[model samples]
Target: GIQVEQSPPDLILQEGANSTLRCNFSDSVNNLQWFHQNPWGQLINLFYIPSGTKQNGRLSATTVATERYSLLYISSSQTTDSGVYFCAVTPMDSNYQLIWGAGTKLIIKP
Candidate 1:
């Protein structure tokens, strides 16, 4: 079993601001993903980055397998970005199952 921890349980950002969310895992992992949970509790996949960096529009993510940590960066935050962000991971030997962290709640102010 693996352990996951997310930083800044809560965050507040002004519209158009940039913010970074961090996730740390206790052990080595093979699969890693970042998700954004909307108000309706629907989880939207942001990235499936086990290592390196990827960017999509105003959102980006980077994972360092050696360091056992990952980061989600939001550029020019919008009101729609206000929600909980989660990081999930799975071991390489496992069946790609995921272990979730508590999540970081983001609030975008006008």
Candidate 2:
């Protein structure tokens, strides 16, 4: 089983600001994903980086399997970015179910 934990349980930012979110795991994992849960409750997959760095517009993520942690970076924040960010993982063993973090709530105020 893999345990997931996210730092800065909550965040508040102004437009154009930058922020970083972190995720730590208790065990080695074969699959990892980052998602943004919108106010409407839709989950948008931001990254599927099992062990690498990826960028998409104002968002980027990096995962280090050796250290058992991952990071999600949000640059030039905006009101549209307000939502809950979640880190989920599936262990190397196929028998385990996906483990999800408590989620980090982000708010970008005007």
Candidate 3:
């Protein structure tokens, strides 16, 4: 089994600010996914980083299976980025049931 935890339960940033969100895990994982839950509660997949780093626009993510942790970096934050970010992981042999962290709620003030 894998355990996940997110840092900074809440975050406040200016519209153009940059922030790094972290996720720590207790064991090795084969699959990892980052999600953003909008104000309307719709979960949007941000990234599926099992290893290495990937970027999309102002958002980027990196996952290290050996260290059992991952990070989500947001550059030039926007009001639309205000939401709950969640990190989920699946064990190497499991059925892909994601174990989710509590989440980091981000607020980008305009």
Per-residue CA lDDT of model 2 for 1-110, tens digit only, reads 56799999999999999999999999999989999999999999999999989999999999999999999999999999999999999988775678899999999999
* Cα-based lDDT for every prediction: 0.95, 0.95, 0.94
All candidates: TM-score: 0.97, 0.96, 0.97
Model 1 lDDT at residue 97? 85
Clashes of each: 0, 0, 0
Answer with 2 or 3, whichever has the higher lDDT. Answer: 2
- Compared with the true structure, what per-residue lDDT tens digits does model 1 show for residues 19-99? 999999999998999999999999999999999999999999999999999999999999999999999999767985899
lDDT of 2 at 21: 98
- What does candidate 3's lDDT look like per residue over 1-110, in tens digits? 57799998999999999999999999888799999999999999999999999999999999987888899999999999999999999987888488999999999999
Q: How close is candidate 1 to the true structure, as a TM-score?
A: 0.97
lDDT of 1: 0.95
Candidate 2, pairs of clashing residues: none
Candidate that scores best on lDDT: 1
Q: Cα-based RMSD of the predictions, in order? A: 0.8, 1.1, 0.8
